[model samples]
Target chain A: MNYKTVLTVCPYCGCGCGMYLPVLDGQLGQPIPDKTHPLSEGRLCIKGWAASEHVVSPDRLTQPLVRTGDDLKQATWDEALDLVASRLMTLRDRHGPDSLAFLCSAKCTNEENYLLQKFARTTVGTNNVDHCARL
Target chain B: MNLPQEVLTEETRQIVSRLLRDNQVVGVIGLRTEHNHTGPHLFTSADDLKELTLEPRYPLATICQAILSSLSQGKLGVIVRGCDERALIEMAKLTNIEMERLVLIGLSCSEELARQCRCRRPYPSHIDVGEIVEGVSPLEDTQVRRLLEQNVEERLAFWQQEFARCIKCYGCRNICPVCICTECVLKEECWVERGQIPPELQFHLIRAYHIADKCVGCGACVAACPMEIPMTTFYTLVQEKLRELFDYEPGLDTKQKSPITTTLEETPLREL
Candidate 1:
């Protein structure tokens, strides 16, 4: 019965169009463009309007996975993060920091992106940062 | 979208069924499909009311205007959401619809449905059916405000970038509830040249000015746009300007007159 609209910037591109992700009883209903949005002004591109599609998508990943031998197995956050951290450290130490590339995601928040880049540049000492929407 | 809410369907059905069986109006117009698919249907019999649905869609009042124009005389019943009711009021003031002959069966949309449409006023001012839910706050349009804040050159550049994506399908004009003209200026070569991909800025400007007074803020144009042009923001700006200038809000009350049609003596123009 509870319904709320969480205002967010579109993650598809740098355009940063504003949209409302409708949450109805805890389920993502649809994405609606914000009319008063300074940038987009209530108009949505195909991607912005269909942004909610991935939320409830059956094929969407529900858990973190780590590759084990040939097949990947679901693992807890601590286990996954530890494995990733150790693997990335080994790659950086052996093949140089530039061998590892850090990719930022549009799905991630601004703070998260900042943290990712800082982790890559300062911690891993790599400047190879990229974005999925680059294309 | 056409599927009735599992909780409210029975109550809504009973109301529609009674309205049809009692012959309150010659026909009751409502949605007849479900599951993100729907179209307006005019129910002439109580049996047809069985198919009546409350889909999260349908531009019923606009279709009703089209129907009303062809008919000489007939009382019509329409299932109206907040925007539909407002649009009908705007149309009636323009003489496009006969308000007196129409019976409105108002329905308050669920908050979830309201949020989906980005509706400011999801429920009609008056309701004849459905549980009354409080209206949610509509998101503000910073784009329009930013455009208004910009210098002429900056505004022009902004528009150039925005309209660059226009496939010029005229979905915004076609889907707009307020855009009921015998001959729209947008179609005219003098205003918008044929086969123009990113149409001349005048094309949008003309349409924007035309619906300024009448736009009910329905976001149908936005949804219909294949290119996903943010047409509603333009109309939203227009409506806001109309409100500020004339202190007249469209589709709020049937008795209220549209300043655009009224003489200056009746509704004096606001000072610039």
Candidate 2:
């Protein structure tokens, strides 16, 4: 009996198409386009329609995994971050900072992307920073 | 031109409150305004009737099907426009919804809304509220007329250009109320090649043929397309052909099987 649709924006891209995610008994349903939205006007791409799938998908990554002996094992955040930092430092020291490239995602906030590029340029000393949405 | 917005809302609220108070329905499905945002809601009690406001229509029939399948018993009342009613009828025929457990509260559309959609039948069969306005003809739409006037080569060229803009989003298929296939052929690699933008003409052709007999002309597909493709123009042409060949219209009755799905004896072709 508890059925309602929650209005939200699509998280897939910058279009920020308004959509509604129907919730029945607390279970999220498919996305429906918002007719009154000025930008999309009830239109959605495939990504918008399937935006909710990732939230409940079993295949979604929940924790960091580190490769050890050709097998990936779950690791704590600290462990994963330390490993990544050490590897990047080692690679930069030996191969040079330009050898490593930083790729950011559209899903990240503007601030987060700015921090990443800043880290790549200042900390990592590499100018090879790109974003998935750059195209 | 039409009933004032407040008058329509008040009348609809009164009917919904009565239904909830009398226990005629467990919940009434309608658009509700909350925090200055409107979306579908299941109002189980009359206390929330004040929030009910109708505008910027959604595919309520699809939502109804989802709710009915979850609930074991209880009659559900839904505020339906002409397109919702047609979608429900089509869904009932496809075994996606149970018509017996539904109480239809028909709300006729305004002439302006009908004209915007180029709707052929803007009013439901039974009008519970609002004035019944004249339906707009799709032939009057310049886009539909442009397609109709084109010859085979010109039509192909036009569609090729349109289809080229397609990002293979599948929004058209996903938003369709009648497309209830659990295993869609559009996903199969054998039918539609994967990882290809501007999918082959077969992708559109297969979908057109699949829904040719069942389309209710709700314009949901057109509304869901991000590329602004005029899908209704193509589907309207197919619907006209179906009417010419079989003398049948979809979403009019639950008992009328699609002429394409039925045997020749059951649904004979009309004399050309």
Candidate 3:
């Protein structure tokens, strides 16, 4: 009785298919396809249907990690980002920028992705930038 | 707004309101609006019955099945299309639902919808609303026919090309009403082999055989497939074969059992 559907685009792919995230009393329900959306037209791939799985998954990572010695220790965003930046700079300076590779996430925004490629090509001076979207 | 379809819908609303007030059912499962999109919803009180609708068809049986399984008690009603009623009947036969605790409010589809579904029997045998119209003759599955017509080598090549487009999303299995098992064979590495795109032919054939006798021809599998692989044609072909061999039609009568499940004494293949 307290059910609701939030219309949104699929977060997994660059296809931007519309879907409805059904919420039952605040819990995630199945994702139904957006019928009127021109791209999806009430059709969903397997990923679209199971989009709710990751949200409530107990195995979802809650924090970033930093390797102290052998084990990965939970760390704050600042600690993690600093570690990554310092490591990237050291790795780039030790062996030219060509040795450093940048990987972009499809889950991030276009602006965020733009920042990634720019960082790699300008700051890192590396053409070894890649995206998760194979196509 | 006194058009025939509108009048029937009004009657349905009145019936639902009365049912709620009379305590005939604790909840009514039907299509509802949320964020401007209409899909399956459970109307618990007569006050929320206004949200019920008949447009933008959905597989209400799936919703019904989900709710029924979650509940240990309580009777429920459904504003069902012919296809929905048929699906419920099939579910009842499979023991997936308790027929005694469920209410069926059958609604006949319009001529246009019948054409869209290419349905042979567009109207439910029972009626709670909407006038029964003529059922359309089933549209020929030209794709399936053409495949069957080819020589062995050509058939192999044709299916290879078709299956090659499969992203192996398994949308067909997820949306199928008959597929209620928790452990599906297609998911096992031993049976299907994971990490491979365009799943092996054994994958699809396994599913086709599983739902051959149980499919209600609701076309949800075809509608949900992202690659638009005509999944319905495969199931429809199998249904046609069942009709030819044993004269068994699923979702018709509760008394009639599937050919595969029935004993020879109860449902003989041929008359003496």
Q: Chain B alone: TM-score in each candidate? A: 0.85, 0.96, 0.90
Model 2 whole-model lDDT (C-alpha atoms): 0.89
**Rank ordering of all candidates by DockQ, starting from the highest:** 2, 3, 1
Best by TM-score: 2
Against the correct fold, how does model 2 do in TM-score? Answer: 0.90
lDDT of each: 0.73, 0.89, 0.79
Worst 10 residues of 3 chain B by lDDT: B1-10
Candidate 2, pairs of clashing residues:
none
Structural RMSD, model 3: 3.9
Best by DockQ: 2
Which portions of model 1 show Cα errors greater than 4 Å? A1-135, B1-4, B34-36, B72-74, B136-153, B260-272
- Residue-level lDDT tens digits of model 1 in B31-67: 6642322345566677755656776465667767755
| DockQ values per model | 0.01, 0.60, 0.36
How would you encode candidate 2's per-residue C-alpha lDDT over B93-146 as one tens digit per residue?
988899999998999998889999888899899999899999988888887788
Which regions of candidate 2 are displaced past 4 Å? A85-102, A114-129, B46-48
Chain A vs. true chain A, TM-score per model, equals: 0.84, 0.90, 0.91
Model 3 C-alpha lDDT per residue in residues B1-272, reported as the tens digit of each score:
12365576678888888878888886787776666666666777877677667777777787777667655666788888878888888888878887788877888888778877778788787877876767655445467668667798997777677777888877778777777777899988998888788888888889877888888888888788878777776677778778777888889987778889878677767642
